[model samples]
Target chain A: MRKTLTTIIALALVAGGVAACGNSDSGGDGKIVLGFSQVGAESGWRTANTKSIQDSAKEAGITLKFSDAQQKQENQIKAIRTFIQQKVDVIAFSPVVESGWDTVLKEAKAKKIPVILTDRAIDSKDTSLYKTFLGSDFVEEGRRSAQWLVKATEGSTDPVTIVELQGTTGSAPAIDRKEGFAEVIKADPKFQIIASQTGDFTRAKGKEVMQAFLKAHKDIDVLYAHNDDMALGAIQAIEEAGLKPGTDIKIISVDGVKDAFVAMTEGKINVVVECNPLLGPQLMDIVKKVVDGQETPQRIVTEEGVFTADQAAAALPNRKY
Target chain B: MITWTRHRLFWPVMLLVLLLLSNLFFTPDFFSIQMKQGHLYGSLIDILHFGAPLILVSLGMTLVIATGGIDLSVGAVVSISGALACWTISQQSDQGSLGVVVMAVALSLGVTALLGAWNGLLVAGAGIQPIIATLILMVAGRGVAQLITDGQIITVNSSPYKVIGGGYLATLPFSILLVAIVVAATALLTRRTALGLLLESVGGNAEASRLVGIRSRGLIAMTYIVAGLCAGVAGLMISSNVSSADGNNAGLWIELDAILAVVIGGTSLLGGRFSLTGTVIGALIIQTLSTTIYTIGVPPETTLVVKAIVVMIVCLAQSPSFRAKVFRRPGFAPPAARPGEPGPDAAPAGPADPTETKAEVPA
Candidate 1:
C-alpha cells in the first residue's frame, strides 16, 4: 500500500507539472477569462448542467478555463487556486457540497475575481463572498410538490404515509427541500411520514431505502423523492412488490427530468415539480450583467412549475429542461 | 472450543443477529413478509436484490484480498465494462448479430482484464502497493469510460442485453442468478482447487511462498483477472437493468460498497482468509440495515449517522476487549470456557493472551 501511495503521488505530481504547460496562451489581450470549476458528473442533471455552462461560455465567446473536480472538494479547491494563480477575470463553480468552500472563495475574492454560483448554492453566512447565486428555488419546488399531493388526495380517507427519498445528507437541496415540504405538509396533522431516507440522490440507493420502507410500513400512500432518479428507483421497488405504483403509492418527486415526465405520463408517477437545470442562458445572462457593472440580485431563481400526468403528457414532447 | 468461537465469521454473525433484533423491536412490522408474483417479496427480498451486485463484487474482492491485494479499480472496471457493452449494443452497424454482440462482450471483458493485469503487474511485478496501483485505474478508468461514450448516455435497446441484467429466472432477478453463479463458481474454484491454498500461502507470507516455489506473481495476476471478469459481469447487470450506459453514474461508489461488504462479511482487508458466503451475507446485512432505516420512518439524512453507529458497533463487537467485557457480565458465560476455567476478567495478569495479541495485530 505504501509503495502504491508513493507511485500515485509521483504520478500526480508529474501530471500536475505537465498540466501547467497548457495555460501559457490565456489570451494575453485581457480577455474575460472565467475559471469554471464543475462538480463531477455524478448524475444526469450534473452532466446537463455542465454542458449548459460550457455551451453558454462558447456562445458568449468567453475564455472559459474549465475543470471537472470529479465530486471531490479538495480537487475543486486545487482547481480554483490554480485559476487564481493564473489570474482569471472571474471565477465560478457549482460546489459539490456547501461547507469547506469559504476559504477558497475568499482567495478568489482577494484576487479580485468575482465568483458566481450555479445550480447548487453555498452554505456560507457571508453572502458577499460570491457575487451572485443563480439557480432553481428548491424550497418552492418542495412546496409545489406537496401542494400537488394535497390536491391529489383531497377527499381520500386513506391515511397518506410519506416515504421521502432525500438527496445527499447536508446538501443544500436536501436541507431546503425537506424543510420546504415539511412546512407545506405540517398544516395537516394526518399527513405523516412513515419512512424517510437519503437515497443519496442515486437510483440504487433510492430503491434500497424504499425496499426497507416497504418492509417497515404495511401501508404507504405517497413517496416524495428529492430527485427523479430516486423516484424512479422507488418506482422499481414499488413495481417489484406486485403493487401498482401510481395507484398503490403515488410518487411526487422534484427534478422535471425527461424520465420523470415519462413515469408520470405512464401513470406510474403522480407529479413532478420541475427544477430547471438548463440555467445556461440565465447563468450566462447573469455573468454578462455582473461583469458589465450592472447591479444583480443576490438570488436569481429560474422559472419552475409542477406537472401532473396530464401536464406531463402535454409537456413531454417539448420539455427540454 | 475457544478456537471455534474465535473464528472470523463469529463476530459478523453476532452483528447480524443484533441488527435483526434491533430492527424487530425498533422498527414497525420489521418481520413482515409479502408475496409478489409467487415469490417472497419484502424487505428481506429487497435487501437481497439491492445487495446482489455488491455481493458479486465482494466475492471477487475476497479472492483479491486472499491474494494479499486489493482492487480499488473494480468499481471503475464495472463502469467501463458497462459503458463498453452499452456502446457496442448501440452501434447501428451490427445491431442484431449475436456474433457481434459476443465479440463486444469478449472485448469489454478483455479490456477490463487487461486493466486488472496492469494493476496486478504494477503491484506484484513493480512492487507498487495494491491500493496505489488500483487507485490509478480508479481515477483514469472513468475518463476512459466517458471517452468511449463521448460523454453521452448510450441507451441499449437490445433484448438480450436487457435480459442479462433486468430479466427474471423462476421469479428471481437474473442479476441475482448471476451473483449466485459467480459466488458458487468462486467457492468451487477456491475450495475445490489448489488456487485457494496457493492464495492463502501467498497472502500469509509472500516471501515464504516464493521460497517454496509458488508463482505468487501469476496467482496475484490471476486474482485480478478474475476480479476484472466479475466486474465485467457486474457491469452488464447494471447497464442492462437501467437500459442505459451512463459512464459517470454507473458503478459510482461501488468500490466503497464492495469494500464495506467484504469487511462486514469478515474478510480482512490485509488479506489471508476469505469467505464468499460470509461476504454475500454481509452484503445482505448492509442492504437490510439500509432497508430497515427506511422502513421505520427514519429520516434519510439520519441514515449516515445510523450507518456509522452500526458499523462502529460491529467493529467494537469484534474487539476482544468488548467480548471479554460482555462475557464477564453476570449471567453471561464465555461459550468456550470450561466449567472451572477462569472468566476473561478473572484471568491472572500474564503474557498477553496469544489470541488477544493476534487480534491486536493489524491485518
Candidate 2:
C-alpha cells in the first residue's frame, strides 16, 4: 500500500509542480486564471464533470489551473493550499467530504480569493466563505424519482410492495433518496417498502441483495434502486429468476447513464431520474461572472431531464456519458 | 476418548453444523434443494455458489499461512486480475470468443502469479516481516487495478466468461465445480505428496528446517505463487458473475475473509498443519452467514456485529483454554490435554493424527 500511496502523492505533487512552474505568480495572456480542484475520477459522472470543466474553461479562454484530489480530503486541502500560494484569480472545488473545510475555506476567504462549490455541498452554514454553490439538490433528486414512481403507478389500487436497493448507507444520496421516495409514497396507502437494503452502490452487491429480496418477497411490484448500476444488476437477477424485469417487476432508478437508457429501451427499466453532471459550461459561466464583479446567486441549480422508456430509444444514441 | 475431540476439525465442523441447524428455525427448507429448470436452487446451493471465490482464496491462504505467512494481497490481486481480464476481454472485437477469453484468463493469472512472487520475494528473500511485506502489495495492488480499469467500471458481454461465474454444468453451478476441482487437486498435491509435510516443517520452524537442508525460501515463494494463482481464478469468477469489473469494489475486504477462513479452518496464522476440507467448511460458514443476514432480515448496519459475535463463538469453541475454563467448571471433563496428548473422543477423526500431525493445534 506504501507503493500506491507514494504513487498518488507523487502524481499529485508532479501535477501541482508542473502547473506551478507554468506560471510563477501570474498566468499567461493577462487573463483570469481559475484554479479548480476536482474530487478525482472515481465514477463516470465525476469523469464527465472533470471533462466538462476542462472543456468549458478552454472554450471560455480562461486560464484553468486544475488539480485532481484523487478522492482524498487531504489531497484536496493540499491543492487548495497550492492554489492559495499561486495567488490564482478565483478558486473553486467540490469538497470530497462535507466537514474539515472551514479552516481552509476561511484561509481562501481571508486571502480575498472567491471560492465556488460545485457538484456537492459542505455542511458549514457560513456561505460567505464561498461566492456561490452550483449543483443538483440531492434531496430534490430523490423527491423527483419518487414523484415519477407515483405517476407511473397511478390508479394502482392494489398494495405495491416496493423493494428498495439503496445506495451506500448513510451517504447523502442514499439518505436523501430514501427520504424523497418515502415523502411521496407515504401519502399513498398502496405503496409500501416491504424490504430495503444497501447495495453499497455496486453491481455485484446489488444483484446479491436483489436476489435475496426476490426469494424473500414473492409479491414485489417495484424495484426502486438508488442508482443505475444496481438497477442493471437487479435486472439480471430478475431475468435469471425467470421473470421479466420491466414487465413483471418495474425498475425505477437514479442516474440517467447510457446503460440505464439502454435498459429502459429494452423495457427492463421503467424510468430514470437524471442527475446532471455536465456542469462545466455553467460552472465556467459562474466563475467568469463571479470574477467580473457581478453578484451571482448563492445557489445555482442545474437543469436536469427525466427519461422514461418512451424517451430512451430517442436519447440512447446521443447519450454523452 | 478425548482424541476425537482434539481433532483439528472438531470445532469448525461443530460450528458449521450448529449454524446450519439454527437456520432451520427461520428457513424451514434451508438445507433442502429444489430443481429449478434442472438446476439446484436453495439456500444450501447459494452457499456453495457464492462461497466459491472465498473457497479458492482461502484454500491458497491455508497453504501460505501453513508456511507461517499471510498474503494480505490476495484481495487486491482479485481486483487486479478481474480488472485485467475484463479490460482485455472488453477490448476484443469479439468478446464472446472462447479463444480470446482463454488468453485473457491466462494472462490475468500470469500477472497475478507475478504479484504473488513479489510478495514472496519480499518476505522469503528479503526477510521482511510477513505482515509488513505482503502489506506493500496489499495497498498498491487495488490502485493498480483501478489504473488498469481507467477508474471506470468495465462491463463485458461474453458467454464463456459469464459461465465461469454463473453458468451451470450438469445441473450444478460451474463455479462450485471449479471450486471442487481446485480443492481436490490442492488436497491431493498437499496430502498425497510430501509437499504439505515440507511446508508444515518450514512453517513449524524456519531455523530448524534450514539446518535440516530444506530450501525454505523456495517453498515460501512457491506457496505465495500458488496463492496468487488461486486469487486470480477467484477474481475471474467475481467479475464474470457480474459481467463487470469494478476495480474499487471488487473483492473489497476479501483478504480479511480469506484470512479468517484460514484461521477458522484449523490452520494457525503462526503456520503448519492445514486442512483443505476444514477451509472449505469455513468458507461455507462465512457465505451462509451472509445469506442468513439477508434471509433472516438482519439490518445491514448490524450485519458486521452479528458476524463478529459468530466469529467469537467459533473461536471460543476452538480454544482449549476457553473450553477447559468452561467445561472444567460443573464436573465436565476438559478437552484432551493438548494436540499430542489425545483422548478417546479425539480418536474418531484422528486415526493417523498422532503419527503425521505432531504439533497440530486446531485451537
Candidate 3:
C-alpha cells in the first residue's frame, strides 16, 4: 500500500513538471515569438553571425528563442520540435549539414509554422516546407576572387601559375568556391593552376601545406585561398620562404575577416572577397514579413563587396567581423 | 643482426625512412636543406617544425599509456592552454612585451596543470575508469576554451611569443629545438629514475603494486600532470606558430594523433613497456606522410583515404603476430614473447600467473 502511494505521488510530480514546461509565454501577449536555431560557435565568422541575429532581434522588439546546436543535426531537430511545441510564430535555423532536415521541416509545416533557413541551406525537394532561404552565394564569392585576380594581371602576358589552398574536403563552400574559380579561370589560357591542396580551413594546416608547396614549386606566381584565415597563414609561410607575399605572388582569398583586412593594410594580402556574416538585421526583417503573412522571395542573397589593399585602411575601421 | 632486427623501434624507423624517401619520386629537393637568412629552409626542416607539437604530445602520452591510462583530454587541454595564453596576451597593454608573454605562458601552463590534477583526482581518488574520467574533460574543456576566447579566434601580435614557435635558434626552428629538449628531458627522467619501474608495476597489476608499497595512486596522478605540462607547451607552440588561438579548431583531433604515435612507437594500450625513440619516429612518419600527399599532388578528396591506407600498412607491419602468420618460413623467427613474461632462457612460469616480471627495461 505504501509503495503504491509513493508511485502515485512520483507520477503526479512528473506530470506537474511537464505541464510547467509546456506553459511557455510564447505569443501570450500577441507579440512576435521567433525561434532561431544556430550552428555552434566554430569560428570567428560563426560567432559574429550568432551575435548579429541576437542583436537584431532585440532592436526589432521580437521575443527571440535562441538555441545553439553545437554542429549537430539532431540537436537542431530537437530545438525545432520544442519550438513547434511552444507554437512559436516563426522558426529559423542554419542547417549544420545540407541534408536530413526534411522530417523536421515537415513537422513544422504540419503545424502551419513558417520556417526560414539562414547562413546554410538544406537539401530538400519539397520547397513548400520552408518560407525562404537567406545566405551568401559561395560560388559568386569564388568567381569574384578569380575576376579580381584576372584584372590585377591584365596587361602581363606572362602565364600565371596559381597554387590553391582549399577548405575542408567535401564541404559545400570548398566545392562551390573551387568550381566557381575554375569556371572563370578556364577562360584565360595564360592562367594555369599548378597545384591545389586542402588546408582544412585552419591556419596551422594552411601554413604547413603552403610550406610544402613552396618547397615543391619555386615558380608559383599566384595563390588563391578559400578563406581569409588560410590566406593569412599562407602569407606567413610566404614570408618565411623569403618572398614578398603581395608583390612576389598576388594573393587572393575569400571571407573578408578583420584579420584579412589587417593583412591587406600591411600589404601581405592582395584582395579579399567578402562573405558577410552579419545577416541578423535581414533575417529579422524576413521573420517579421513571414509572420505577417507577407510574400518573401524564395532565395535572399546578402550583398557583399570586394576589398583590395588600397581600400583596406579606409575599410578597416568599419569592419564588424 | 637478429637482435637488431628484433628491436621494437626497427619497423617504425624503417617506415619513417620509407615515407621520407617516397617524397623523392615527386620532389627531387625533398632532402636538400638550404641556408636562407641564417635559418634552415627545406621540406625536411618543415616536417620537423610542423611535427614538433605531435612529438611533444606523444612523449607525454607514452608515459600515461605506460601507466595504463588513456588521456582523451590532451587535445582539449591543448586548445585551452592556447586560448588562455592568447587571451592573456591580447589583454595586456603591451602585447609584445617579453614579461607579458612569459606571464601568459606561465598562467596557461598552471591552469592546464590544474585540469590535469582534476582528471587525476577523478581517476585515482574517485576510482573512476580512466577513459571515462578523461572523456569528461575532453568534452567540457572545449567549451571552457570557447568561453575564455569569448567564442572567437583571439589573435595576438607578440614577437617574443612568436619566438617560441616560429623563430630560429641555432639556425633551426625553435619548435624543433623545443621538442628535442622536451624529448631528451623526458627520456632522462623516465630511464634514469625508478619512476618508470613503479609505473610499469602499477599498470601490470594494480593489486601487486599496492602490495609492494608503491603509491600507485600518486604515481598515476603525476604521469597525468606531466602529460598536461607537455600538452601545455605544445599548445603554446601551435598558437604561437599561428599567432592566434582557435578554441574549436586548435589541436582538434590531436589526441588521436598522439595516441597513434604512441602505439606506433611500440607502446601498448594494455600498459607495460614504452619507447620514446619509437614515438619520435612515429610522429615524423605521420608528418612526412602529410607532406608527401601535398608534394605528390594527391587529389583533395582522396587525401584522407590515402592517409588511412598508409597508416593501416604501418600498423600491420608493427604487428608481430601478423608477421609471424604471413612469413611462416623456417628461417623466420616466431613472434616475440608476450610482454611481462620471462625470456626463453629462464624457467617457464605458469601461464596464469598474475604477477608481472620486470625482466626487460623499456629503451
Candidate 4:
C-alpha cells in the first residue's frame, strides 16, 4: 500500500508538471498571452461582465487564460500564482474583495508582469502594483439615478416620499450608491427618504422588504433600488399592492441588465442608471498598452448612460444582458 | 390552562403572536387584511405567503431531525430544483403552457428525489455521518445548479407556473394553500400511522431500535427523500414568485433557517419527539421578525444584530431551565413549577424525557 501511494503521488506530480509545461509553451509563439481571473457569476451583472471580457479578448486576438475564482479570495490568489508561473504577458482580475490582493499582487510585480483590476478596485495603498483599475463608478451611478429622479419629479411642491431598497449592507455599491443619492437628493427639500432597507441585492429579499415598506408606509411616492433585480422585485410588490409602479411609485434602479430593460419597456421601472459591466474591450486595450510599455492611467472609468422607458423600447432588441 | 401551557407548541405560538403584536406598535394597520382585486393583501398574509417556503422546508427537516439526521443539502437542492424547473420551462416552445410547467415541476422533483436518495445511501449504506454526507451535496449542488443555467439567471414568462407562488386561490395566496396541504399531509402520514412512533424509537436509541426489528436504515433514507421533496417544492415557489431562477441566490442560507425553525419548534437536534405545528409557528415567527425589522424602522446595518437578539430571546423563552431561573424570585412562582405540579428540578426525568419510553421499546 505504501509503495502504491508513493507511485500515485509520483505520477500525479509528473502529470502536473506536464500540464504546467504545456501552459508555458502556448505563449511561446510571440502572441500576447493574457491571464484573467474573474469573481464568479454571482449575478446577471457579473455574468455580463465575464462574457464581455471573454469576447473582447477574442476580438483582440489575445491568448486568454481564464480562471473563475468562484467568489473566493484564496482561489483568486491561487490563480494569480499559476499565472505568474505560466509567465503570461499580462494579468488582469476583478478582485472578489477590495483588500488582501497586496501579497499576490507584489508577487506579480516581482516577475515584472503588470496587473490590471477590472469591475472592482482594490484598497491597496501602493499605486505602482497595478497598471490600471477599469470599472464603473458606483457612486456616479447613484448620482445619475438621483439626477433622473430629480428631473422626473421636478416642479412638484408635494413631498415625494422615497423608499430606498439598498443592496447588501456595507458593500461598496450599497454604501457609495446610498451616499451619492443622498447627496443629490439633499438639494431638494421636497424629497424625503422615509424608509431605507437592504434588499441584499436579491430579488426575493427586495420583494419581501418592499412588501414590508408598503405595509409600514402607505404613501410612498418613489422607490430607489441599488440594483435592477431589486427594482424588478419591488415592482412586483407594487403591482400586488394595487399601485402602478412607474406611474404611482416612480421606480429608479441601477444595472441596465436585460430584465431591467424589459421592465422599463413595460413601464414598471421609470429609469435605470447603467453601471456598465462591459469593461472587456477597454480592459484588453489597456492590457496591450501595458504590455507595450506604454504609460496608462491608474484609473479608467467605463462610460455608461441612464435609460428611460422610451429608450428601453429602442434598446430592448439589441440588449445583450 | 396548565395543560395548554405545557404543550410543546405553546411557547412557539406565543412567540409568534408576540412578534406579530410588536408590529402593531409600528404600523397600526398590521392586523387589518384588505381585499384587492379579489386577493387578500396584508402584512399577516405576506408573512404566511413568504413564510410558506420556510415552513415546508422546516416540516421536512423536523422529520429528518426526528430520524437523527441533518440534511445541509436542502438549500442546494432548492437551487438545483429551481434551476432545473426554470431551464426546462425556458426550453419549451410554449413557456406559458400549463402542461409544460407541470412537466418541468415533475422533472425537477424527480431529480431532487434522486439526489435525496443519493444522500440517504451515503448515510445508511456507506455509514457516513449525516452532516458529512449531506455537506458533499451541499457544496456540489450549487455547481450543478449553475451548470444547468449555464451560470446565468434563467427568467421565464410562464403564467401557469407563476400560480404556485404569486397567484391567489379563493382570496388566499396559493403558496399558503400549498403549505397547508403539505403540512396536513405530513402530520397525517406521521401521526395517523406507525411512522412517527417508529421514527422516534429509532432516534431515541438506534441500537435498541435495530434490536426491535425496525428498519431504521430505510426509515432514515425515507426522511431524506421527504426533505428533498419539501425543498423541491420550496424551490418552485421561490422561482415562480420572481418568474426567474438565480442559481447562486435562490434559497441561499435557507437550510440554516430551516434548522433554526426546527430547533425553535421545540424539536431537539438529538432527534426525537418532533412537532410539526411547532415548526409551522416557528417559521411564522421568523417571517414576522423579518417584517417587524422593516416596520419598526431598524437601521440597515443593525438588522442582523436585531434579528440575532430576537431569535436569542425566543430560544431562551422556550428553555424551561432558563424560564425557571429567570422567575425564581421569592414572590414569583416559576412558570414551570405550578402549584399542583412537581418542579422540573424535582423530577429530573419527568415528561421532558419522552425518549425514555422509546428507549425501552426493545425490552
Q: Say which candidate scores most in DockQ.
A: 4
Tens-digit lDDT track of model 2 for A1-321: 587578769999998899767767466568889999987654556667788898999999888988877667899999999889889989989887677889999999899999999977887878788999999887787888889878887887888889998876545567778888899889999899888888877788888888777766678889999889889888988887778999899889988877789889999999999988899999888988988899999999989888999999998998888
Model 2 alpha-carbon drift over 4 Å, by segment: A1-43, A57-115, A124-131, A288-294, B1-6, B21-29, B326-363
Deviation from native of the Cα of residue A174 in model 2, angstroms: 0.7
Candidate 4, A56: how far from true, in Å? 1.9
Model 4 chain A poorest ten-residue lDDT run: A20-29
Provide i-RMS per model in Å. 2.4, 2.4, 1.5, 1.4
10 residues in a row with least lDDT, candidate 3 chain A: A19-28
Please give, for residues B146-252, the per-residue lDDT of candidate 4 as tens digits: 99999898989999999998989999999999999998888888877788899988888877898989998999999999999999999999999988898988888
lDDT by residue for model 2 (B170-264), tens: 99999999999998888778877778889989998988998999989999999999999999999999999889898877888899999888777
Candidate 4 regions off by >4 Å? A1-35, A69-90, A96-113, B1-4, B325-351, B355-363
Q: How do the residues A1-321 of candidate 4 rate in per-residue lDDT, one tens digit apiece? A: 476568769999999999877785658788899999998876788899989989999999998999988777899999999999889999999877677878889999999999998877788789899988888888898899899988987887888899999987766688889999999999989999999999988888899999999999999999999999899889999999999999999999999999999899989999999998888899889989998899998889899998989999998887788
Instruction: Give the lDDT of residue B43 in candidate 3.
Output: 95
State which candidate, 1 or 2, has the greater DockQ: 1
Instruction: Give the per-residue lDDT of model 1 (tens digit) for A109-146.
Output: 88888899987899999899988998988888888888
- For residue A296, model 3's alpha carbon misses the true position, in angstroms, by 1.1
The prediction achieving the highest lDDT against the true structure is 4
Where in model 1 is the C-alpha error above 4 Å?
Answer: A1-17, A155-158, B1-7, B26-33, B92-105, B152-159, B319-363
Candidate 3, residues B104-141: lDDT per residue as tens digits?
A: 99999999999889888878887778998899899999
| Global local distance difference test of model 3 | 0.87
